[model samples]
Structure formats: structure tokens, C-alpha cells
Target: MNSAIESLTLDVPDTAAAQAFYDEAFGLGDRLRFTTTDAHSAGFRGFTLSIVVAQPANVHAFVDAAVTAGATVIKPVAKSLWGVGSTLQAPDGTIWKVATTAKKDTAPPSRTVEEIILLLGAADVTASKAFYVDRGIPVAKSFGRSYVQFETGPASIGLGLYRHASLAKDAGVAASGSGSHRLVVNGALGTAVDPDGFAWAPAEVRAGA
Candidate 1:
């Protein structure tokens, strides 16, 4: 079964505010599925959304737009050992990492952000990896106790696991209690919770979707 992520649904106190922030900031205004609810309290603290780009120029553009749209910049855009990137918190308190595989170039290629990668902070990477693998999602890359990148089916977004505390610090957010995460994944795992409290649900697919 080829299950892909359809949307990253967010349940915020004010759906309009959160939706507007993303739309105005990253053109992702339409990508999110917003629901006003207290089922999962405000100030979500578990997962992160990674916005990948093909060019450094696009990374810079994205970070800049995020800041302009009221996102708190945690790490400024700069050359990192991994690549060119920046980390910030959105108005709704969700952490976002704008990055590209390309290194720092005097003139990075031009592009825009369109991709979304979901990173789940696992209390135990090994256990989390085992959970998903057992559920049929294949691992694209693994770093033993450190990390695991899952390879979802066609049209699905990227999924990865990082040590909870470490990832929270990296994204500059609190690694606290988890309930209804206000996050969703369209996958074969169906509606369930991983070992670390993250939830996954089936995505609705339309004609040709």
C-alpha cells in the first residue's frame, strides 16, 4: 500500500489566525487543515515541519518571509555543517526549519517553498522506528539510536525521527507533555499513536489525488 501524507492538520485556538499566518508567510496558507479546538491545548510542543528547498536562494526567501510574518527566528539563515538553513517558530508556536541541500553559495539558485517534511520527536528512536517499520513504512535512512528517516509511498511527504529533547532544543521549543498532537499524517498506519505519543491518521484522497 502506497500511503502518502495529504495534509498536516492543526487544531489551534483560533484557526483563522493560524491559517492566515501560514498563508501570508509561506504561501502554505492553503496547505494546512485548521480546526478550532481545545481537544489539544494551544502551544503544541511535539513535532516540527521541515520546509525543504532545492536552492539556497529559496531558503533565504522562505526564512525572510517567515520573519516578516511574525515568526520568531531561532537560528538565522547561515551555512551549517548540514546545509544552508534557518529555524523559526510560527505565530501559532509551531517550529519550522527552512533548509536546502545546497551549501552556502555566493548566489544560490532561485526557487520557492512547496514541500513539507514532518519530523516526529521520539522519546525512543529505536522503538519508534520499530513501530513504523512494523506497520509497513520502510526506512530510507537510519542512524541507530540517533535518527531514522522513513520512506513513504509516492506522493507522501518525508518522515523522520529525532531524539525528543534534542529535536525540541534544535527547534527552540519545549519538549513537554503530549495529548491530541494537533498533527496528522496520511499513511497506512491509519489512526494510531506511535510509541512516543505522536498520532497518525488516514488522509482523505479525492479523484486523481
Candidate 2:
């Protein structure tokens, strides 16, 4: 009974605005959904949603669309030893990262996203890793106590954990925040909060997802 993520529900002040921005920026379709909420969240929300693409061209396309659609640039697109990527903050205060390991264009440019990853910033990576493992989520990849990726299936949203401050730094944000996480992960893990305060709910089936 391994657990897997189905979809992510974001709590925003205005669902209409979020829907518009998401549609224009990433066109994520049903992989992401939204709900209206006035929950008080400030600074980093202890997590980031990442769009992993096929190449640098796609990375630029998504980041450009996000910026044009009113997302604030947290980290401009740049190349590193690992890959090229950028970080942005959506109008709803959610952090997003667009990245790819292929630094050069392999084929015609397209905005097709390869995967959606939800990375939780855990205070104790090892402990948080154990918590999810106890819930029947198998580890896909791990780097000692620094990071852990779970086997959430190819169709489901990817899940991972990283050191709290390191995750914030990767997203180009300060590691200080309070109030609700403003995110709910719908998955087979049932309803519960992780060690880093990420909430989870029962998975719900949606058309075309």
C-alpha cells in the first residue's frame, strides 16, 4: 500500500485570479487546483512547487510566461552545474520553480511540462523521511540526511524533502514564515500533517487528470 500524491490544492484569496495566472503561466491543467481562503501566510510557505521541463527552452518559456502573467522573479533564469532554472513568486504568494537538466535545446521548443514536484522544507530531513516511509511511501532517491524523494508514481505529482533553510535558499527566499502553509496535498496518505507542517488529504478523482 504505497502512498502517492494525486493533486495539490492551493488556498488562495481569489480563485479566479489564481486560475487565470496558472492558466496563462503554466497551463498545468488538472495537476493543480485551487480553493478560496483568507488564511494568513507570510514569507516562505515551507514548500515550493516545481515545474520540471525537458530542456532549457521550455524552462525559459514557462518562466517567461509566469513573469508576463504577473509572477515576481525571485531568481532569474541561469545555468549552473546542475542545470538551468529560475524561481518566481506567484501573486497568491506561492513559490514556483521552473527548471530542466538539459542546458541546451534538444528539439523544438515547447511548453510541455515533464513533471510537477512538491518539495517540503523539513527541519529534520531524516525524521521527516521516516515519517513518510512509515506511511508506506517508498523512497525513490535520497542523499543522506540532506534530501529525500518519494516514489509517488509517474502520473502523480512528485514529492520530496530537503533541509528547511536549503530549500528556501534554492527557492531564493528567506527561511522565516508563520501561519498556515496554505497548501493541501491530496493523496493516498489520508488526512494528516507532516513534520514540517504540510497538510495532506484523501485523494479525489477528477475528470481528465
Backbone clashes in each candidate structure, one number apiece? 1, 0
Candidate 2 residues 32-122, lDDT tens each? 8899777788888899999999999999899989999999999999999999999999999999999999989989889998999999999
Whose lDDT is greatest here? 2
Best by TM-score: 2
Q: Model 1 over residues 1-209: C-alpha lDDT tens digits?
A: 47456667776668878877887677864357777666745444678899998878888888877788789998888887788888998876678899988785556555466567898888889999999889888899999898899887666667899998888888876666555667666556679888877777777657797
lDDT of residue 28 for candidate 1: 67
> For model 1, which pairs clash?
23-29
Predictions: Cα RMSD each: 2.4, 1.8
lDDT of 2 at 165: 96
Runs of candidate 1 with Cα error greater than 4 angstroms are 40-44, 105-111, 177-180
Q: What is the C-alpha lDDT of each candidate?
A: 0.77, 0.91
